[model samples]
Target: MKKIRWLPSQQDSHNRWVVFFSLLMGVLLDSISWSGDWGVAIPDVTPLILLYWVMAIATNNFLVTAFFFGLLHDVLYHTGMGTYALIYCFLLYPMLHLRLQIRNKTLVQMSLFIGVWMLAHQVLVWLITPANHLAMENIAFWFAIPISILLWSFIFLSLRVLRRNMNVR
Candidate 1:
């Protein structure tokens, strides 16, 4: 097996407030889209932000934050208790392993990671969502993937800037 070089960018990043605010922004955005009466596609903000943080900063720390955000998302969105928490927490395993592998410095790579994760997350959401929520069948939910893919670059770049500003590792 080839020994891959993991970049030392994490060593340069260490802004706790940025991490907190970025994750917080993600959850807030998700909630706004969930509760708002918007008629268009809204990207799944949580995972996208989570992916960036996991890839760009401290991957291990995010698992705990993911669980909390998941619970917060569950309660705020009313998608049923533990649903969002479980999904967010469940996603961390992949994120942890994929951390160094996914270099978000490039748009294509970021798109690939975002697309795959969103697809998996949505598919799982479809399967695991409680029966009661099944009633709202078409949520323009299908647009989630493409929208998220398109937004990944913007979010990635924005977070890159945020990371730079905060100096988070």
Candidate 2:
């Protein structure tokens, strides 16, 4: 029988800081509000960032990470407790399961998946919050999906470069 190790090794431990900072950046990006109605067009950056890290790094336990960050998001956004936490966990579960297949996909293919993913996230947010019920009718509400899809390549490439440069396993 094989045993599982929960703790990261000395070298692997360094990646935690990297992942933390990147997710923090995502949090920051998510918190910023765009001027006027443009805000609705901005996609949720944290999840996209989370998706990148989840797909890139296999060893780390992102479910807990996602939960924590999602909690942070809920607090930051002043939403109900466990709202984003539940959403993040729900979204990341399939990604965690299909990480290998997703990792192998080309950037264009990945963007399409990301579009669907973001759409789902938006839908989840709409359903979870009563305030967002009317948002679905707005054109900008749907803009988030395509905007996130466009950002996918940039996020993926930059994070890939960061991981490679940092030598994160």
Best model number under TM-score: 2
- lDDT of predicted model 2: 0.89
TM-scores, each model vs. reference: 0.80, 0.94
lDDT of each: 0.74, 0.89
lDDT (C-alpha) at residue 5 in model 2: 77
**Which candidate's lDDT is highest?**
2
> How well does model 1 score by local distance difference test?
0.74
Tens digit per residue, CA lDDT, model 2, 22-104: 99999999889788876888998899989998988887659989999999999988889899999999899988888889889
**lDDT tens digits, residues 1-169, model 1?**
9977575344434454577788888877876645443333576687788878888765345777788888888887677888887888777778788777777346887697778888787776777777425424667665777888999989988998988776675
Misplaced by over 4 Å in model 2 are 1-6
Give candidate 2's error at residue 90 in angstroms: 0.6
